[model samples]
Target: MFSIKSLHKIIFAISFTALFVVWQWYFVKSVFNFDFLARPILADGFCKDCNVILISLDNLRAKSLLCYGYEKNTAPNLCSFAGKSYLFKNVYTPSSKTQDSHFSIFTGLYPISHGMTVPFTSVLDSNIKTLPQILASNGYTTLFSGPKNDPHLPLDRGFERGFSYKDKGDEPRYWMDNMKKNNLLNRKFFAFLHTYRVHEPYIPQKENINKFYPGGPLIYVTRNDLCKKAYIKLLSQYPDRFKNLKVLNDDYCNIYRDYNTKYAATWNVEIESYLARLDPYWDAFNNLDFLVKKEYTHALYATSIYEMDLELKKFFNELENNKLLDKTIVVITADHGEEFFEHGGHSHAANLYNESIQVPLIIYIPKSKSQIVEKLASSVDIMPTILSILGIEAPEKITGIDLFSSKENKFVLAQHVTANLETIITLKWKLILNGDEKELFDLTSDPEEQIDLSIKNTNISNDLENKLNNYLFRLPKYNSIKSEPFPTWIDEEQRKKLIETGYF
Candidate 1:
């Protein structure tokens, strides 16, 4: 009993619905390759079927790892795995921070090129091609696991879009559970695991509490308690300098909030006084002597690494049990290194010293020759190397080179936005330039970067400065939106968190 016009309208609606479904299915099939979704692809441009796993350790200095010549057994499991891996001894990251360094890793571009040099409110361009994006296009199921509360890392950026299964924590069980739920055992897969255990306010499990701090002067109380006491005392002295400051509790430490007034000299003065009070506790390591309470902090840092190593061992054992280790390519590296008053700085993202920029790069490929490569490498190289190994051609505009390529990288760059800093590292020399200040170190003689050779070696300083300037100019500028300006201000939640964790 419907009218002729109404019947025609219903027919049109049904036709439109059918067309939409067909288009959607076609899109999915083209993008995901539903026909051959389960097939695995080898890294040698063949179809032998292999899996790729990228594990990023946060705030882990190469000097702290036993594999990297540290006296401590912080990364024993990693050391054991390095026996069958290709270890790159001189690997550096593009940025001395987590957000930008990881971006440089996922994208084969430096921090300046990607326009994500700063964190909190920074957004990745939708058009940018990420590692997961490339892998997903090639019939690989992409997964991600990182810090639960770091919004700058996951959803705000486009990284989460390329991942099919992503968890909020760095623990391997979360990734394993997701993989199992998706039935990804036999399917091609790429997993990115990010762990921040070795980062600031280092608090480890109860069992590992006394492992490094046994009978130490500050072993009776938590490092966070002492740090908070100092910070509260400073706050009481200079309340005006700490305006808009708030406090947040991380899992390991009590983070003092950040503020716009953090740049004021008065605030720094009070903080310096507090640091002076705590210097004795930080001078436990005499080799790398600096005036800061590093013993308590470093002990906790080592314990965290030990805990993470235990989890890593467990993950490796699980893979072995499942017989998946033989077919998987495992990459282990860090976003950036930590500092223990190495250059009068306690944490990272403020300086570009070796202790802040140098990281450990261990690549383990199944049935491959294990050799230690001393060639210069950067975080940017990770993307190209991954793509090259996976039988995929890198993007045309990629700046990073393949790690296994015959050609050697002559120089690598690292940047930090706090001081508008730029650093250039060559085989023999390293130049760190901040505004009008320049510091040149002869790496061959001064590995610790303790000697400043800028005044004595003007020729070397000028040459490196020119190279850094030219390199930066070659990269793209920050241009997120044409209509709206780039967002430099961070939100309150992220700002507070960053400040608490010494990001500011």
Candidate 2:
């Protein structure tokens, strides 16, 4: 009953549907051959079949780990695993904050070069050369799953998958949850994991706190009550240091929160409201730290660290189980580090001190089994090294060095943003330059960065300043590197995350 044209149309529709099914089945996850989907095919044929996994722990300072120094067993499992890995003694983040630090991380350039200064509206460009792109361009599968700037899965960036916060969640719980949802809890490939539990108001539950502070009930006793007579009864039994009720008050005003007619200065951008806390402002942070420490027995802190430890055990086991362990490269580091009043700063985005810029870095080179390098290195170096190891030619524009393959690290760079242009760190010395003035520290003599030798070591200070000037001058300008603008529908959740982590 059908006309000739109608019959012809029906035949064409059936053929197209049949072709679509076959295309998906043969080309997608069902037959995910890395050479075609993610990475751009390349010549020289030296392909790294190695599964690359990069882990970034947020607000984690290197010194807190037993693997680094710290008397407390903060990262016992990490320490245990350090025996079989190459632990770098000193690794620096390029900036005191996450945006700038991560910029250096993703692009291999300094903030002075990459230009993502303020957290308000800064974004990393698409054209910027990132690690995932480099790996993907050389017949390797790439999965980028973090901040928006992460070099993966934007449909345009060539990631096999992109778990950017825009399309997915960014909480630490979401990371684990998503892994389970995707049935990737055990699947091994080039994966990057970022954690943020140690960040601010230090909100660890009281139960977790009890593990650390054994003397008290671990309850949030009001500051008013702590400064009153009743609690002082218990205090009187203790030493003179705890004698005066007012002494325990630890009261102070934070003007950073206050705005008045007396000051003529106006903010170009909205300043963050001052975060006020009780007398023991660090109660939350301590509890979280306890949770981190509890892994030895109760295993809260140790539990989280060791949870990753066991997850890693399963992870590595899966790799071995899947015949992929021998062919993998793993690098562990932090985006930015935490602050525990080392420099009178409770969190980051304050200054460029060791607590803010220094992070732990471990490179478990495949087959090498065990090695440690003491060279001063930057997070930016990881990308170049991976490219070099794979024998894939990295774009020459990168600012970082291949720490293992090259001996060129006489000095490195670190940055922070304010119109002041006040923050900087170098190999032997760390300095903060505000306009014409400077604050200097000799990191070699004082690793904790307590002693500021600006007046005493004026000569050395000047020398380092000159070195910084010449180096920065020679380095590429942030504006010079052209990059594709971020999407028009910008993700503000990422902005909120920056504020939450104190990047404001």
Candidate 3:
């Protein structure tokens, strides 16, 4: 009755229609029942006397940790802790930047809601209720200890409220010293420790460097500080060679401005003219990528992770020796994850990819058995989760749900305000909307986000977009007064110092 080609075409059309209908039905059912799919409460609440110890490791990714299936012993101590703590398998940061992610964690609000997204300009509003302020009001002394020299993290930004001791260092000795000197261990306290050692310029000790890169090239054997020095000298000598090289401006010094002041002064040429005359040829300077892409880079990053783990191990041992571990809740997480050529770029604040937003969240509460929480969670959930664990009611303004609740939400939202990117990720799908461009990934099939199914799966894409918009609509307008912007702009003098430190 019909030609063979026509019959085949008819069959294909019917099959496609059936698949589309089935997919739409499945998507709707999953979105509605996602939270209930695996709704198991992992941990119990803590007593009122329990103290809190929060640790933030910068640029640490969930996949980098051995507990998360990394083959390397990058974080042995963390792995041990993970076995004894509630390891959140699907936790993400609200934003992929350091300052903005921390703001979301402390304030229990999204970046836009808190009015702190940019590092140089965004400041935490004083009117916003922060975790430390609330804990201090409830008779818990707050303490902050991290690098004292970073200009980006000043105490005036409302994060330092109720902080009795704010010191600097990546090591735990200084913090322990202060705790003993201030009689903090005897009191109910909330200590927040941030470490940048695991961040860029991965300057692990020589032992760690050698351990990771044994018998490797000396160029790769050097720590980040040394590598930075060499890279800086090389760039400084041939400033014209790297004029068009793509770089994160915040991570590096303004070399063009520096060269103009010093070299142009000697050459008697205008800075603008000198910069304009430099021919753009990044391909010729292929060594730049080579240096960063070498095995040494991976080794250095791994070594840093190991070194951070050792520090935490020592800190935890000290706490355990003092019997503090039995009475305190320890929360270890990161602001964001680093990327190594993932999605064609490195470091963070570039995309909403899993490599950039997914962070390790390990929470150890006293007298609680460890279990992995597979539900979707974000940085904003930390504040509310901590409050709930302490048996305190979260503020009405808090948008995050209790991660321990069986009724945890179906989806988690992550954003990058700088790139104008927003994402809505469920257990099965991730949809990223960047202006007019859209990318959809099926996490079950493509966890690497290598494929874009937006065009092929238009129904799923539209559904996720609608969900994202609905969630965004619930956010109250941010009305907090913004703080004065701090000066992080580089000048001629600042440029020289930044270069020596291997910045940029």
Kindly report which residue stretches of model 3 are placed more than 4 angstroms away from their true locations once superposed. 1-45, 149-151, 221-295, 480-504
State which candidate, 1 or 2, has the greater TM-score. Answer: 1
> Could you give candidate 1's per-residue lDDT for residues 188-249 as a string of tens digits?
99988887767655657756757776754343345655556656665686688555655764
Count of clashes in candidate 1: 3
- Winning model by lDDT: 1
Quick one: ranking by lDDT, best first?
1, 3, 2
Residue-level lDDT of model 3, residues 1-504, one tens digit each, is: 999999999999999999998998789667775444454464335546589988888889898777886778898888898789999999889888776788788888987788676444455665688888888888887788886534345466556666877876556556676677667899999888888877765656765577677764344323322323433554665567556553354333344345444553232223122222211211222365554564566677888888878887888788889999888988999988877666765556358899888999999988888998888898899998888788777789878877887666689888887668899999999999999899999999898899999999999999999999998888854654545433433446543432222121
Candidate 3: residue 251 Cα off by (Å): 22
- Which is better, 1 or 2, measured by lDDT? 1
Flag regions of model 1 displaced more than 4 Å: 1-48, 206-210, 214-217, 220-292, 482-504
Can you write out model 2's per-residue Cα lDDT over 454-490, one digit (the tens) per residue? 8888887788788888988887764522234443332
User: Which of the predicted structures, 2 or 3, would earn the higher lDDT when compared with the native?
Assistant: 3
Worst 10 residues of 1 by lDDT: 251-260
Q: Which stretches of candidate 2 lie over 4 Å from their true place?
A: 1-47, 147-189, 220-323, 419-427, 478-502
